[model samples]
Target: MRKWREIFGASQTDVAKIMGISPSVVSDYEKGRRTPGVKFIKRFVEALIKVDNERGWVVCKELIKSLNLNPEVIIDIRELDKPMNLDTFVTLVKGCLLTSTHSQKIIYGYTVLDSIATIQSLSGNEFWQIMGLTTERALIFTKVTTGRSPMIAVRVAPVKPAAVVLHGPKKVDPLAIILAEKEKIPLILSLASDVNELVNSLRTYARVKIIV
Candidate 1:
């Protein structure tokens, strides 16, 4: 429950208002003092759908897909100069995939974001802003050290990107690899020395549109 809350970037107050329940009840659920019944769970999911709609993101759409719930929405997809898959993306950036369930997934573009900036300023609502153009894009995280923290942020997101590229990391954290595999989001570690150069190369090659 806590994990889902964090992923949605919803506060107890937000959930309480949407659920028409008390904030203490939400906190109790997170604290494991009580468990939500099936009826409450259904309401929780419905509330999440409402939150997704308000946030202008398909996060709950993806969540519904993962659950085989068949959420229907008009997806906005775009393409770059050529189809960019995980394999080609890694090669172009001189990186390696540590974990991937779908290597053939195609992405329209890339967005280079500072990991620290995200940690500091990005709220759950702002996730769509950072993704830019569409959610079906690659998110390249700069100033990454362990690669764990940023990937954790992605895992908690309602909509997962096609792939995640971590720049300036020689080796990625094992837990980060696990999180990516669990989410089925491809995790890549780039050995690129210069973050600016790598971001520029990706933008030019992928023709990525920056929304945020």
Candidate 2:
């Protein structure tokens, strides 16, 4: 519930106003002080959909499109409890930065994808699901060859990720680097031995809380 509220960029006051409830009630439900029943859950989802619809249904449309994606395309997806610095994330993933931008950015989540499965299966609109709850997250593509196709898919998408990491690519295509530079998204090359190592590293990173 809290995640969806943040994803929609809504305040507790805003949701409460629409739900005909007090902000404290909303907070109570979110914080687990008040356990929500099935009716409340239905109302909460409907309220979020209502808010999104009023705001032009941008998020709703993306979510609807995302339903078309095959499960094989996505290996893993997670939203972090706390944001982590971009530098720390790169180090955790054993990544080599390939682009100049986004040094000071923070990542809220990450999604691991099978590059071949993604490109061959999903359409332009369906790619938005990779963003997860927020675009302020890493989009790591595994089994990359030249890294061109992944970057190309990101290039045409409306929402961009905090960073892009291409795993299992010995050398990235120059065009991919150019696209990352043009988009100003920090591109990275993962130095993990294989998919297992990369996924394991990210999973470890996800569980640890950064002090800074």
lDDT of each residue in 74-139, candidate 1, tens digit only = 111223556677788888767887884476788766656677666665566565544443366777
Residue 29 alpha-carbon offset, candidate 1, angstroms: 50
- State the C-alpha lDDT per candidate: 0.69, 0.80
For all predicted structures, in order, the TM-scores are 0.58, 0.67
**Against the true structure, whose lDDT is highest?**
2
Write down the TM-score for model 2. Answer: 0.67
Tens digits of per-residue lDDT, candidate 2, 94-149, equal: 99898885768899778888988987888676777555433887889999999998
Off by over 4 Å in 1: 1-79, 128-134
The C-alpha local distance difference test score for the whole of candidate 2 amounts to 0.80
Q: Lowest-scoring 10 consecutive residues by lDDT in candidate 1?
A: 69-78
